[model samples]
Target: MIDPLIVLLIGFSVIGLGILLVAHLFFMDTVQKTRRGMAACAALTLLLVGLQLQHLQHLSSGADLLNSGPYAFMLCAVPAAFYLFSRDVLLPDVPLRLRDLLHLAPVLAAAFLPPNWVAVMSFVVGAGYSVWLARLVYGMRRNVGRFRFEMFFFGLFALIAVGVLALVIALPWTGAPLFYRAYAAAIGVSVALVISVLLIYPQILTDIHEAARLAYANSTLKGVDVEGRLEALNSLMTRDKLYCNENLSLALLAEAMNLSAHQLSELINSRFGVSFPRYIRELRVAEAKAILSRDQRSSALSVGMMCGFGSQSAFYAAFREVTGESPAAFRKKQPTA
Candidate 1:
């Protein structure tokens, strides 16, 4: 028999996570669909925990109660809710259409089917959604940057979703009552980890919102003169020496060129085939090389600072990344006057 204290602790933790997620809906500055999807996920989690607590208490027919139609629907809906949340968070511009509801048809079907069939259907849906979620995360790997921390937490949630489904399906085969308790405990822990991270770094959600908006803009903009924009961007960096600003940012540069940050980011990624940071680093390294060749007496650190590198370490790293040699070594190779 599972300890009553452990069940209570897990139940309260899941309830706390649900409360936090709901609170986030109000606290978030924007009214995005992602918030609603997250709330749905939290509700499902709470329901699942409640069902598990009932089972642990050994109330008459408690296991049967958990296997009932409503419980099966909630079990199946959790992954679907997570998928919806992930889609909204990662691809906000993609409208949720009627076809998306088809993903939940299995849950509805499970409600009418045998209890064993419900478990089978839920596993299939959860496993497929987990793979899809993983692919979405992989695609965003290049652009996520500091947002990868949030991605890691979401990945944990996805893994837990799959593990829970597997444990449910394999429970009959293994005849291991302990696996059910383990599944409930895992869900509680996963929710706690996600909620704690988000509360600590709420900016992650804001960053994701901005990134999704930028991605949407980049995809939809059309009829614009790519060549002209490229020329303007080059002029800003080469002639105006915007790259020489240590505090330069995509948004700042975009504002100077009368473009959106997304537009500028897309231009750099498509035209230069590099991210904004890499483009700036290349420009700074090129300037540093010119200074090194022209003035052999100048220290590498001085040239690095003048060229807009924020630190000597960053200067050397970027220099070596571009030139395959340290700045000091590259300077040494230059001929004396």
Candidate 2:
């Protein structure tokens, strides 16, 4: 009979890989380069885990192939691919130069290294990339609110990466086979955690990417009237209920405020301490609460539409996120005036 733990690990790995591939397909057109590199990393992770699963089930392929030159090389490349993808997202202003390819140098070394040396080198390289990831993520704390929704998950992923790096360092003692199992298990858990976050906030990735771009880009609000712009924004959102427009966007709202998208993003980030998307969502959710309380007869779907949500699910998600209660529950608790 198959070990239940191994079966569970394999299930998680496959599910994670499928979700990553599907997400890549959905996001390919918009964030082409970054998503492509991320997809590549996800594929390599799946390949490594799938091979481990095969060995775990059949026990035909001995530990030899698991620790072989090519397999080790692929294992070593995972961290590099993740690093490059994250670099593109966090430091996109720094164009990739030929020298950036040096990040993959360890992969070549791992390809030809002796079996024992492969594990040691993989540990060293993974550790370095893990540290680099820490620095990159930590450096963005100043603009944390820009991607606030993702910060917790990003931290979770960092913890997972650190755990994997720990596994790499223990490879010799635990043996290659055991290490592979633990690594694959970590990948599965990471995927499940990310998918949960996505289910809650489907717009997370796009919001993070937009915020990261604004976080790193040079300020475009120089010489601009920040106070006046805030006043106008308040008027548009409050008196006019501009957020009620389903088609409202960062660029469109920026135009109304007589500011560029970047300027408006920076203004929102600096003054409101949130991303443009979150700012709009908060306004919409606030309006939603009022409608839910005041207009007892208004259906939840119509109220969501009137409050600017594009879909019923989106409205419920955002409303629950803000109020900690579902729309129906929140409405039920309100006293009829």
lDDT of 1 by residue, 245-281 (tens): 8878777898998887667777776666555666788
Residue runs of model 1 more than 4 Å from their true location after superposition: 30-62, 147-155, 176-179, 209-337
Tell me the whole-model lDDT of each prediction, alpha carbons only: 0.68, 0.72
Indicate the TM-score of model 2.
Answer: 0.82
Model 2 steric clash pairs: none
lDDT per residue for candidate 2 within 251-326, as digits (tens), equals 7899999998778988998887777777888999999998888889988999999999988998998888777889
Count of clashes, each model: 0, 0
RMSD of each: 8.4, 3.5
Residue pairs in candidate 1 whose N, alpha carbon or C atoms collide under 3 angstroms: none
The lDDT, on a scale of 0 to 1, for candidate 1 is: 0.68
